[model samples]
Target: MAPSEKDARREARRRAAHRRVEPDAAPAGETAIRSDPIRVTADLTPELYRHLGRHASRAAEEMDLPRVPSVDLVRAWIRVSDDPLVWDKVIKELRRAKQ
Candidate 1:
């Protein structure tokens, strides 16, 4: 025995509806994480991702040791990369950490 066309259509609609937002209401004044998702258009090599993951892990470890604002971390990274002197200082600090 085969399923009817109506049954198939109903199942499809049900699946589509299920994919939509849930009906459960949320309490007022609740907020979630604010940072936007980072987009990457170009393909990232496996090595690049590995390096990024390592860098992020190290930064997270440092943050755990000494809690710092995410904005401050981002600003520091930007500033250091923009200035050769600051970049040198940052590299020195990283080397000191390894020692």
Candidate 2:
């Protein structure tokens, strides 16, 4: 089959898998990782939470992934910002946010 045809088949399978689970619930056999007691947490404002959700949804659609969890995106950002330039930008943002 052509690549497009293969991708279509894969997408169809993903949709089918999604349909088998409840809309707001994790799929069967999936344990909730957040239930652990020793987890680090950050409090986000409602606006920021919604923004993250929108970004994650757009990223998932653009990448043709099943879902893009916001935590994963934040982790990627942290991983990529190891350079001094990135640190400077972060400090600048923090200073701006303080005003």
Candidate 3:
């Protein structure tokens, strides 16, 4: 006895359908982390915009890591530049990076 073409097609479809269905497993006990979105608006000169993009790309490449959101990076920049203490700390860190 041989299977018909229709039966083979149906069997293949059944196997594919079964593979597509995910197994319903109970979630392991784990806490989900939550984060709030930060927003900002800014206007930049063309040169400054290019500089920011390059800085962000270099930051991303240094560790072959995920890129930080531009908003977060910009917020960080503003926070550091606005505070003398923070700027001093940043300069110290940069000096260390050079060594």
Among the numbered candidates, top lDDT falls to: 2
Which ten residues in a row are the worst by lDDT in model 1?
A: 25-34
lDDT of 2 by residue, 23-98 (tens): 6756644522233345569999999999999999999999999899998898887897898899899999999999
Q: What is the per-residue lDDT of model 1 for residues 12-96, given as tens digits with 9 covering 90 to 100?
A: 6565556454566333223222245665354568986666556666787867754444444556677668688888887898999
Per-candidate clash tally = 0, 0, 0
| Best first by lDDT, ranked | 2, 3, 1
Task: Count clashing pairs, candidate 3.
Answer: 0
Alpha-carbon shift of residue 65 in model 2 (angstroms): 0.8
Best by TM-score: 2
Full-model lDDT for every candidate:
0.62, 0.81, 0.69
Model 2 bad stretches (over 4 Å): 1-38
Q: Per-residue alpha-carbon lDDT of model 3 for 1-99, expressed as tens digits?
A: 257986986676566556555476323222222244656578998998888888887777885877856665677687778688888888898899699
Q: Report the C-alpha displacement of residue 36, candidate 3, in angstroms.
A: 8.6
Runs with alpha carbons beyond 4 Å of true place in candidate 3: 1-38, 82-99
Assess the local accuracy of residue 95 in candidate 3 as a C-alpha lDDT between 0 and 100.
100
Error of 1 at 39 (Å): 6.3
